[model samples]
Target: MIAAGTASMGRAATPGPSRWPRAIVRLRLALRSSEAAARGGGGGRWAACFRPAPVAGAAAAAVKEAKGERSAEVEVEPARGGGEDVWSARADAEVAQGGGFPEHLVVMVNGLVGSADDWKFAAEQFVRRMPDKVIVHRSQCNSATQTFDGVDLMGERLANEVLSVVKQRSGVKKISFVAHSLGGLVARYAIGRLYEPNNRRASSAGKSRDDVEHLEGLIAGLEPMNFITFASPHLGSSGNKQARFLLLFYEHMTFKSLPFLCGLPFLERRASETAHLIVGRTGKHLFLTDNDDGRRPLLLRMVDDSGDLQFRSALRSFKRRVAYANANFDHMVGWRTSSIRRQHELPKHRLLVRDEKYPHIVYVEKEVTNNRDTEARADLYDPEEEMIRGLTQVPWERVDVSFQKSTQRLVAHNTIQVKSYWLNSDGADVINHMMDHFIV
Candidate 1:
């Protein structure tokens, strides 16, 4: 094992602005966590580090050479988010020609440490079924946002890109969204902020006609008729009491936890209350309130005990005040503060609901819905090879829970399992369900 002292520090060749270090650190920690989980314990604690595949890039080169045409039917474009201002850049005609981007416009957002390649199979399905639609990747994964200007903050930047993509696509009346993990937050922030009159007051405050037109264009862009997220922490969950407990431990233990959240483009993504009010089962916001002040003791103890990260400590204090004293939310995000329309029952239109009745309520209806049953497996994906291919077209097309009619009702957190099953299985039913909604 390498000594902690042996670690060397040099500036990142390209340090992103917010949570730049946090993303890198989280990326490392996630790798370590994956390894630790994989090891299942031996005499030594081996950290599983799934460094990016070296051979994959080489293989891409080899395929390029063999094809001889030097062109690919499927173009793997870089994701754009956290601000490099590339989202507005139009898809090239070659990439736009014929079958490419032929259907209704689909804007895909990825989870943390994920990339466009992540959407590979789903994109292929969309391309085959609805060949005219353009599915643009939200590039937040590419910059990792630590040093980049626009990429910082979870949902804000992501929302902007989504708007831009929808507006740019010709004849696009309806827009669809598919996001995973924190990527959902990014989309949420964008969608929420776009409609906020407070956020759009600048338009009426004396601007040029051209500026006003651009503003209107941005605001009135394509309508978000359908939305889907994969295992997103929308109602932010750790899946179990153990995960919930560990999140508490991490908040008090790790310095890197809190600020990492605010870096996303999510609207109003303040750090302080994430763990306590959003994800915590007992916080004021969640359905489970057995421990109303559960997180308080942990935060106080962390500050009193051994040194904790300053940013984290500050967040603990901030979140405590905002959440405990005011809003009362947590890590998994609260339905009251999520990208959903709150209701006594699931909304008949938007499929992604802020569930109140079931465990892991976000899961899709498991039983087949009058369609041919072709998939038998729950999941066949290599989760390790994922994360890098952000808005992957991977067959992980989940069920289109965005049913026009709401006969099925899902518990809030149950979505995790539903999403997991689709992403893991890459089933045709899942793809077809999404397509059904998109075309409809």
Candidate 2:
């Protein structure tokens, strides 16, 4: 998932396509190999690779390895019984989900730098709120895949996974989504490639845009209902926090893309123009130090050049495909990029239902009464002050189910585990709303 990083939306020539392509290829390869090493017994040196794009059923395919040393062929047990090679084809098990769900099949996509396990708590809440409905999880590339290019295989993979999930779920005829951060971008790219129309007949020479798009459309015909993105930076940054060098490169480079990035096409000059349009007040968060045994750098600050326009381009390509939206805050993504700008085209959609605020859990953590006073504080808030006194309070932001679509943004950067007593909390409520939209 794209959080705070630097990628602009404009197009620029990669300088004669000479050394740049080779360099990109080399960089991409190194990123892939190093990331794999980092993931596989390397002691977690890098952040987890971005989640793989979606697939329908068969394990999604990758761009044929540049190195003859191919990746281990991935095999997936399709929920559906079909044995087709196409990733989007449904399996028998997935078809079963169509039975009689109280809610629709809402596939949950987790945030950047996380996995399906990350949404386990939220899924539990959904199940509790409406047990009769089917709640699905989109297994991203991060769950099993380990490569910088895993995203290269995601869009088609996800396109099919949605079909299989709904087909096997018994009563579900269509699928909906609840996504966070880069997961949303991945989903959009997958959906667009799968659903976008292209009738022109192109040669099998190379992976041309129209050709790639057509292939994507063939898979995306499996349209699901109401796509949602949480705290996803759809608009890219305006370059407020970045130092001068990166901004300068962004202006001159018009960087349409990086070889490592998956999906969206990176145009150079267009990217520069887009960077100039940001509203630039990103959220602030307590840096998550020790998040990965101290190997992970603290990423609490949101400076300029901290976002990519590739995701924004991907989102823009199929903005129409998304029906509703939500956001989580202080987690990494900013509020400005997650908006719909109150779409002038779609009367039925206002883009997002944004609920920005402090999460209640951080305030109500277990308190220490006899601490020797280790850390310093600028000014303590309610829950922090309460914690110092060994007291707790109900986290208020934990009150809402995360997927509510009534507003344009949701600002809870801190998420608390909701009690799952057969679905009584906000997670459950959000799931219920999804059910009403899809399964009903």
Candidate 3:
């Protein structure tokens, strides 16, 4: 017993130094485990604070690499109204594109029951692709149910919102609009309100043709550039006879817009009668049923310059006007209305080609019309015909998109804009096409 006790004491005294190293190692491993657990949200609240923060540049690069996007670093700041502005740093933009920081303001408007988030993908793509030439602002003023308001009220709201944005960003010298669905109509109405002739009449008394063209003036005192719409009902949402006949047999249809009624005669007629009950004043406007104040429908009045609202002139001020329409499966908006064409004007299906770069872009047509040929016809009683004639006065580049072969064809309206990246990734090419062809 005495020998055993003495041996234990001897060993305890001699190996104390070695034992200390083992103890320290055990402690370190315990701490690491706790840290890992805390990171995984298992336990140990304070362990997260011990971790080092990732370097900003490295983190951003990692994200870009993971997403396979070569987009430059951008900053997003809250702007007036419910919108947010996206722009890259001047140094980064110049380094990436060898150009000055963007001076153009691109307003992105959302559609029915939509918010600023609807344009998130497109807005980001715009800033990423044209970092040196454009700042994208996603509009949120007339979002969600607010879109149910009549076009005039929404237009006024949008105009005020835009003016607020302009006042906040005095550095912006150019303006453009990118809208979807109902937002297109809202944008049109807003521009009409924002248009200033620069005393065009006073300056045109003795000016040359060239000089008069130059005096076309500005939108909100800023030079207008591209005005683009995606799946917008430019000719209103009333269904045409051809579309109704084609969709007459589809029984499992959903309520999207007027055209989504599957072209059934009874459904279309019933929808026209009760559209206002569902979407409020905006529905009335879309169906051409709003005859408030004993006047023609608001959509009809918007086709021409009425009183101070120079609707056509405002459109003419822009350098480019584009309409992106879904040829099929966009039940929400009819191709004819979205494309601003008559039944006979639609391009043949055989003409559609799949470009390697833009697989979904089926066709593109640029319509050029002489000013004399597009003079507003006041005598025309057919509202749809009048609108088609009125808007075609300014040349439009119509881009036809078809998801006819895609798994996501059913939601072509949302897909065309990549409204939600994960769900609508198939529409990415359309956005890429827009970015590739976008004018600075």
* Number of the predicted model whose lDDT against the real structure is largest: 3
After superposition, candidate 3 runs with Cα above 4 Å error: 1-72, 90-101, 200-215, 241-267, 370-381
How much is 439 displaced in model 3, in angstroms?
1.5
What lDDT would each prediction earn against the true structure?
0.33, 0.33, 0.72
Supply the global lDDT for candidate 3: 0.72
Task: Please give, for residues 1-440, the per-residue lDDT of candidate 1 as tens digits.
Answer: 11121121112123465636545465445545544554664312212222112245534542232223223444444433232111211234535554233434566665443455345445544544443354534344332322111122444556566555544544454455666545554554444444423234345333444443322222223433445654443333222221232122222223222222222332133222333333222221122223324543211221121232121212111100110000112233333223221223222434554233321123343222122222334577422112112212111222222211221111112222122221122122334445555532
The TM-scores, one per candidate, come to 0.38, 0.37, 0.74
Candidate 3: tens digits of C-alpha lDDT, residues 1-440? 32343243235334455554553344344446444664575535433322223346644553342234634466778987658988766635475676555779999998877788888777776776676788888898997667768789999998998999888977677899999988999999999999878675333233344644564667877778889999888888775533232221121122221123332355466667655545567878987889999998999989888889989899988888999999998867789999998787899999999888899999999755534444446776667877888888889999999998775575577789877553455787898888777777
- Report model 2's TM-score to 2 decimal places: 0.37
Q: Let me know the TM-score candidate 3 reaches against the reference structure.
A: 0.74
Best by TM-score: 3
Q: Determine the C-alpha RMSD for candidate 3 after optimal superposition of all C-alphas.
A: 19.9
- How big is the positional error of residue 82 in model 1, measured in Å on the Cα after superposition? 7.6
